[model samples]
Target: MQAAADQGVEAIRILGVKLINPGDFFELLLRFLFNLIVTVVIIRFLYYPHSRRKDYFFIYMIFSVVVFLVCYSLASVSLQLGFALGLFAIFGILRYRTDTIPIKEMTYLFLMVGISVINSLTDKSVSYAELLFTNLVIIAVTWYLEKIWMQKKEDFMDIRYEKIELILPERRADLIQDIKKRTGLNVYRVSIDRINFMRDTAKIRIFYRQDSNVGPISKEAPKQTPPVDS
Candidate 1:
């Protein structure tokens, strides 16, 4: 009978099933709720409003949950901090399976990962108050940076310029004026790409600020319609 009991214990051990404290489970649940709230505020209010990209809302939510569960599962580790840091370091190099991540989206990805790790790995030494405060600060800073301070500089468009004569180093002002007339944008600045002498055209990148605060500009600018050759 004793041998059978020992075998049963060993079986449970092998299956990684251990008795969990209810208090610890509750704490984890609370942390998950808090993190979800923070993530939603940042994604829905701060990010999506400005970007108008709905795809990342679900992506970030799912990613945060996955990361939180993984971190929570590894709670008994002696080197949990180092392990968590290494795990996020791995996430740092992540490439999107669907498409290449833009700089803004990638930054938000890092933020979501960081917040998930922090919430899931809440150390017993740190008070819940401190964690809440930390999350609030992150949300506030991101909201201010994204929606307020950097709003004016976010819109940009790319266009192809067939007026090779206006693309000269001396004619940069002319190029700016031309872009403003064509696009009806208060162009912040212009970046001239490689000039194709053979094609007699150059790609012009326009960084502009939208005047109204209604919605962001569409991602793709209209393709340049070059003049037809007679």
Candidate 2:
């Protein structure tokens, strides 16, 4: 019975089963917890506040979890380089037909994938301290760029302009003035997306720069209340 028990334990260890190898299980749990925390910090603080796109937020979080688990499972293999490269290639080609992801969102996705890969696939040659430092560096750089360095945020809106004549090259200044008066946005530039001749209206996209703290303006600005309300 003693010999049989020893063999069973050895088999469990070789198979990397959580039932007997508490150390391996604990290591996986610790790394997964750490990876999750890092992912939350990056998505919630560094990325979401600026973009406010819930779809991509969901994508990044779910993708991180799946990638981390998959890579951790495959970490026992010696082909780390080829496996890592293939993973990168798989993530690089993701696309959506309805709306192509913007470069900024794609960048955040790339960062999340890289972080998950690094956290999960480290061999014995790498230390926990080094893994942590790498994740911290990525978070620090992202925070600095999103919060400190870039104060101005550019936003856009699409509007249907009835004055198709004003969209002409000669009437460009007049068009801008009219759009500003109507929209109450500090419009810096405009692009004509589509022109509807039947309705004599054109689809226009306007760009404006505003401070990060300021909320984005709506498609139509709302009327302000009388001063007596104050």
Candidate 3:
């Protein structure tokens, strides 16, 4: 009975080890940690500082994690590279179908997906050092472009204006000055989008150099003057 009990205990230990697969689990944990650190650096530190879009911040983080986990699991099953590329294309198209994402946002999304794939699917043939270097390169390039290279970005917003008089071609100078004073934005140019003679209102788009000090403003026009007609 003592020998039989010992054998049972040993069998249970073997079963637990088989179920746990400690080696693969450790590898997954290691890769996931690296992937997460790289993603947060890109999205939280690099992108958020410039764009300041909370919605995209959440989307990018979640997208990166989900993509990483999915790719890693599929890779364990020996999924082909083509399958991963196909998955990337599908997600990209689905994102676009929901809304027309801006070029910059799309680019970031691409980076997140690509980074997830690279980190998760890389085989034993690729050393961990090589993987780390590749991620660093991507992060370095993104940081350079976002912080050092592109300085002086132009932003625009559409506004419904009650002052149809100022929208006239002859009053363009006065119009720009008035908008600047009202909105406190450094308005450089204005374009009349539409005129509503019946309501005495005009839709206008204003362009200005985005000031870092002023921070990110919403796409919706500020209500500095009269209430805009709904």
Candidate 4:
């Protein structure tokens, strides 16, 4: 009876190993947790602030959740090719009718998705050094592309308009030109806010270009040519 009990115990241990290997399970759990944390961070820092429409945020969050589940499942099972093709077809049919996202924001989304995919496929027992190196590479590439190389100087320029009340017989072309020269922004449109003949002041709004900080405009004036000799 004792021998039989020992055999049963050994068989149970083998069964456990076959059912779910500790290394595989641990790796999956770690990947899931990491993906969740990173997704949350990206949603908070990148997605929530710039997105004006509430529907965009909602859709983005839902997409992230779906991506997480698909990646997790992929790591566990060898999905059939037909199913993968079907997924592609389904995603192709999804239409987002909204304002275009800036390149910077799109890059962040790509990075987040790439990281999730990488983590899902990574082996659990990889050395710490290798893991750290891979992470550093990802960070370095993302920073180089988004912050250093792809960022535009024009985006930093602050262009705003101020509304004023005044009345004049002619358009304020000279004043608008002066403001453009000083602010280095071309005024695109102007609107009349209010006009009170009795007050003798026409409320006007001036749209000008200015840097992010109201400072000396960087635009240089066109050189004046001397009069041609007769």
Candidate 5:
């Protein structure tokens, strides 16, 4: 009778221990789901539109999803540090031959990875409300910077200027003045290509500022003198 009672107490304690462990299957599923949802949301909403190449956006989405799943699963198993370092090393090698990514896109990738790292290191039972809030803040700030500040300031100001080539012969001073007036930029350097002695014509080329505006100059027809008839 006493032995039976002791066995019952031991059984209850075993069940209690199982309940309190953080490695339970349900808890692992919940953490993975939370991380997966936020990561996908960030990639789709914040990172996709800024990318110039549609193919890159698709690749980014797929890569982020896989990374999130692997990182979350590793976290559940409490092997986060080892996994993170290995993944970092792998990416470092991958970056060597990879095409350049825009700074904005790189920033988004960093944020996504940073969030995954934080999620992996956090306790399983901790409320995910704060995690969700942090993701929202990151996405909002990145979106605002990319759309409102960077694009507006750099759009027209960073024009690619080139040297000008002139195929018509005209007065040098008049041509220079006309170019300045038309482009709103001072010519930095001017090179005279050739002079035709037969036609008394000249070809000139110029190097000018990129942001300077250039357009065709309109000419007014010369007025005819009235005939001085007897």
Candidate 6:
């Protein structure tokens, strides 16, 4: 009867206060810790072996917690679908910042957001068991994709490239040769970020195989080499 009475009280509720539901609050606590554990496992075991960024480690933990809270708070509203969509819409704007988000980190962000939405929302159609299973499935899939299935990805670099002559269509081979000589990267493709004919400079995004030595942002300037004979 006590359990039934409590359910009755919660069901008829029109509005929710953040701390009103102790059960929900505890669930949030558990969800936050679970997410943290899963995220750490992914980052520490899978991603860290590749990128090795400590800053991103901190950011992912904090970001996941904040997203979970937002979802939990909005779950009680009548228009939850709209609210959830609105939440993700805000993340889209994060891309336009000066430093673009990498595809990997962006993917993790989406995963965290999705987990948050799933963990927070209470629905009759989806029971607690289903939610638990859903979270576990996501973790399992991520582990497999990151660790087992995909062994490699193409490496990329953002360079302040300044070889306008080599970048021309007629000198494609020369460009590759020159870049390889200077940076020692097996550059497979180049993308133009900016062009300044006046300054004889063009910002280049270089894509290469994973074996390439160049990290995403290599501070050391490429050594100037003798111009490759055309």
Tell me each candidate's TM-score: 0.69, 0.64, 0.64, 0.44, 0.51, 0.58
Off by over 4 Å in 1: 1-20, 96-98, 154-175, 190-206, 211-230
Residue 118 in model 4: lDDT = 58
How would you encode candidate 1's per-residue C-alpha lDDT over 115-142 as one tens digit per residue? Answer: 9988887788999889889999999899
Q: Which ten residues in a row have the lowest lDDT in candidate 4?
A: 158-167
lDDT of residue 161 for candidate 2: 95
Full-model lDDT for every candidate: 0.81, 0.86, 0.88, 0.54, 0.59, 0.73
For residue 44, model 5's alpha carbon misses the true position, in angstroms, by: 2.3
Off by over 4 Å in 3: 1-17, 154-209, 213-230
- Cα lDDT, model 1, residue 61: 84
Q: Which 10-residue window in model 3 sums to the lowest lDDT?
A: 13-22
Number of backbone-clashing residue pairs for each candidate, in the order shown: 0, 0, 0, 7, 0, 0
Task: Assess candidate 3 and give its lDDT.
Answer: 0.88
Per-residue CA lDDT of model 4 for 1-230, tens digit only, reads: 97776556545655456544455567667767766665665566444543444665565566656765677677556653444455445544442344566454555555565556555555557764665576567666655654445333232222233323212336566556655576556564455666656645545555554333343343345699999999
Ranking according to lDDT, highest score first: 3, 2, 1, 6, 5, 4
TM-score of 6: 0.58
Clash number for model 1?
A: 0
Clashing pairs in 2: none
lDDT of 1 at 134: 92
Q: For residues 23-115, what per-residue lDDT tens digits would candidate 5 score against the true structure?
A: 355666776677667776667665555544567567666666667767765665757787777776776676666887655566666666667
**Candidate 4: segments with Cα more than 4 A from true spot:** 1-23, 40-62, 79-103, 123-132, 144-152, 155-179, 182-230
* Candidate 3's TM-score: 0.64
Taking the tens digit of each residue's C-alpha lDDT, what string does model 3 give over 1-230?
97776556555655456444455788999999999999999999999987889999999999899999988989967565986889778977887688878788988998999999999999999999999999999999999988877677678899999988988899999999999999998899999999999999999999988765466587864568867899
Best by TM-score: 1
Using lDDT as the measure, the top candidate is: 3
